[model samples]
Target: MAYIRPLANGNFRADVRLKGITKNKTFSTEKLAQTWADSIERNIKAIPLMSSAQLLEITEADIESMGGEELFKQLGIDLFAIRHCAKLEAINALSKKELLQLTPQEIERMGGADLFIKAGKRIRYKTFREVCDEYLSRWGKKDYKGQMQRVDYWCQFFGDRIMTDIDIFDLREHVDDMIDAGDRATTINRKKAVLSSVYKFALSRGYVDENLVRSVVVDDDTKRRDRVLSDQERQRLIKACQVSHWDKLYLLVLMAMTTGARKGELMSLRWNDINFKDGTAFLGDTKNGTSRELYLALVVIAELKCHQEIGTGLIFPSLELPEQPMDFRAAWRNALKAANISDKDVLNTDGSVKLERFTFHCLRHGFCSALSDAGKEINQIAKLAGHKSIQTTMRYIHQGRDQKRQIVNELAQAFNL
Candidate 1:
């Protein structure tokens, strides 16, 4: 309701308030006090009246008639928004013929004229890290195993920086730093790909003008060709596994190497996901939530059958969590000790002998390599590996065993062996 009172100097003062404006703060409008009071009464009496703001929509003529801030003070409206209204009122006073003489910056300073900026335009200034977080928050549960792990990587790198503040030069520095550290082209490219995804998401949301990361070129030649283990290395790893203390660890390694399932998929498995009689395991929710069935290798089946227990649901239950698989690090360290391998030294599929810098994922690679050696088609290999595209599976097709053997035999034949 609004009320007008006579002030001490014969001036009129208006007091207006809106009910249900907020939990406590009341809305005030002395400039349209009379209209507001009538509207409040109409609202209380179940009658509709034109809104006070609509009725008092300021016009060019109204501004000159009202004159200045003193006229506003006389009306008893003291809000800061009135300053904006006055500023606009003054700008609208400009004659149309004289408006063209103003500079672009000067015209922009007239706030009312800038209202058309957001129309049909996307805002894109978010940082790579911010976009990554927003992406994860909205879609993390549906992301692939590789993507879920990269969250820590990005957060560690640039979580504190604002998205708008980052530019191509900043990305170039980060990429150069990675390259200088002897990181392989594949590793550097993967990080760059993540950045590209962030930009793509930002583009969709109108946060970026362009994907600057895509414009910069990465050294694609630095990709490491997949190198499979030699027959002797595979044999040694199998031999070491026979004497391993954690039998499940050996089984986990063997399953990964044979089936090419990712570490997370293997670790998340339960007895219910497997079928011993049919010799198959049904993965209910893969990277894309599509169920997939894998043929259990004879070797993997033998390991599972030998260690089968009736105590729990998890196929690979942890010592601590019981319902969960133990952290691979604990068993991985032990495996390394048994195989006499360091972090820099790669293990064969069975985890024996120091070959190179390959880690757990190399086991999956070993599986695809063996499959390719056995004459499996590229598409079949991709399906088995759970790759969305054959291009991803291509990296796993290491030089086959037959190919390597042929090379060795050719050398011997060339020497007249």
Candidate 2:
């Protein structure tokens, strides 16, 4: 058995002096030294020593069952002054503190799980934020707006907690809290999706054993909102866009309403991105890296070429720069106000809207609704909207012709179809 002894220098150490055993392993911290001694004692008890004539035969699993600490002890392994340093060359090596220091962005830059394993020094409880950064850096900035949004949502909902601290219960509570806070079921689900991805990342990296999100039970009391613009509302907003006098805003809206490119991709348009000769606009960066090709109708081409300012690199150059794209927030607000849409009444305190659910994104909805009303195919609609899936495009189509009947019934209710 190992015991603690005081040195002449007034420091204490663990001294395990046994015949035929390594001796006098000193420790600055008494508790650590004691742990070391106890581990060695346990190893000696488990494996009886044998003379040269007869060897103590033990299976590999027998040694492993004692755990890394006891197994190393039984083997009479003396780690360098820093125990972790010596184990760095062995299996099941990890550097907990060092792993904690790396940011998510750093992890993403290191690439996939294989790369992450190679790069991360063993760490304990790698925080969610670190994982988030790595996910973002790996996914890159442009394509991960939704993921970034979810990361922000989690950070705001629950301060900066370490990754290991997250449990299935915490995620369930967070979803419940969002529901109580009056978020749309869809929005809540989207946030859940982000959380799910984080858990998946943890599992893939061997950080967590299971995905907590998969076990989470979402509340069925959530509401589904896929509000699309009516023809009258569309016309009103169109008029508002025209009144703002940023013809590009009007054109941008028209493109979204006509082709259903996402607001960001549309606003990010440049002269070089347009191929007027072939009548197609090449979208370089999009949600999917498909590089969408949108056909420019005659009306779209006319609107674009009419105010085609010379020497401006951006098709929608900023009014301030006259050489760059303009900030669209002020323009968007004015257009909404002109349409008589009061944000206070429409949007909730938490930035979620109820009935007249509206945003720049609604223009794409307007386009989809127009197509659905016109009896377009799901695949055709998906391609036009640049949707990654037919189901995503079909969701905008709605069902049972109820919305379609409502359009006809509106006229009949007023004046007998």
Candidate 3:
């Protein structure tokens, strides 16, 4: 909990005291002030007690004595720039002599000592974690779990970094690190998108005048993986799952291939989401953030009916935690290996994974590929797949023999050849 008060200067002040750690920032708007208070308090709560104490006890004298640009570096806070004691005195936030005399705890109590020195370059800084906290609190309650997961990932990447210190290069390098570590582009882009959202949130609140995340280039071609299992590969995959005796994994892959549903959406399915008689299922949670009904294949309907006879709640409940969906990662990887879909995993002398990953999401690719090969129009495929945009489905329309033949026939008929 914290407090927000309007000052005579037409600015809003927000302050919170947590486990003796305090943050007090003033903003031009009440919304901004409240947001900062909420975010700072939340971050303080999330921090380990020792780390929070370290942050709280950084003395003003310790910083002022470091002098000019070297102050931030010595403090290990901001690498870019910082406001010096003279500037703080000019703003009447502190007197030069008084600021140098105050302890970090005293600075906190006085609502002075703008956190993070910017190497005398003066960065209007905000903590990445706090900004993410503000981002989630402002618009995240509706999608708490999903949004929090993104926030958590961003916190790990930046770790309470001064937002101004991170530029396009840093953002790109972080994403590249993920790529080199064998993360799928979608995963990397999703994390990048979270940062972008936070920057946008900050921009709206006047935390900073710029949104640096916008300048970071994402591969235009690789936003989503277009991988699909071939006919032989799909057959081998089923056989491998059968051999593994993982009944749930088999049904999970089958459902994904037949329905084009996302991993989370499929995981969320219950007997109630499916209507076996009507051969349809309703998705309450989807990437598009809307609910929609999708037609089910006869085979999928039959599978659901059989499973419903035995399964109680979740269609894919965890083996250990029945209320939650099973972690399909291990079995899925083993199946991929058994199907010979994966390349050699034994590291080379220099040490590198020999294969590209084909994740469970690829099963949705197989579903879309099947439709495109059957000559369904892009819009029809989009509707069936519950995609909010037909443009997204257009990516799946590969030009196979049927499509080529249609193009050839159209050209020939037009020329009367």
19-105: candidate 3 lDDT, tens digit per residue:
665557789999988877786666555433325345445566743432322424333443222333344444355444443444444
Give me the candidate number with maximum lDDT: 3
By TM-score, highest first, what's the ranking? 3, 1, 2
| Candidate with the larger lDDT of 1 and 3 | 3
Candidate 1: misplaced stretches above 4 Å? 1-141, 144-162, 177-188, 216-223, 310-312, 333-356, 400-417
> Using Cα atoms with residue i matched to residue i, what is each candidate's TM-score against the true structure?
0.61, 0.58, 0.65
Candidates in order have lDDT scores of 0.66, 0.67, 0.69
Q: For model 2, what is the error of residue 73's alpha carbon versus the real structure, in angstroms, after optimal superposition? A: 16
Quote the lDDT for 253 in model 2: 82
Error of 2 at 64 (Å): 35
Lowest-scoring 10 consecutive residues by lDDT in candidate 3?
115-124
Task: Identify the runs in model 2 with alpha carbons over 4 angstroms from their true place.
Answer: 1-125, 129-162, 172-191, 215-223, 245-247, 309-312, 317-325, 342-355, 398-417
User: What TM-score does structure 3 among the candidates reach?
Assistant: 0.65
- For candidate 2, what is the lDDT? 0.67
Give the clashing pairs for model 3: 81-117, 81-118, 81-119, 82-117, 82-118, 82-119, 82-120
| lDDT per residue (tens digit) for residues 94-141 in model 2 | 355445444455444434234445444454345677777776777755
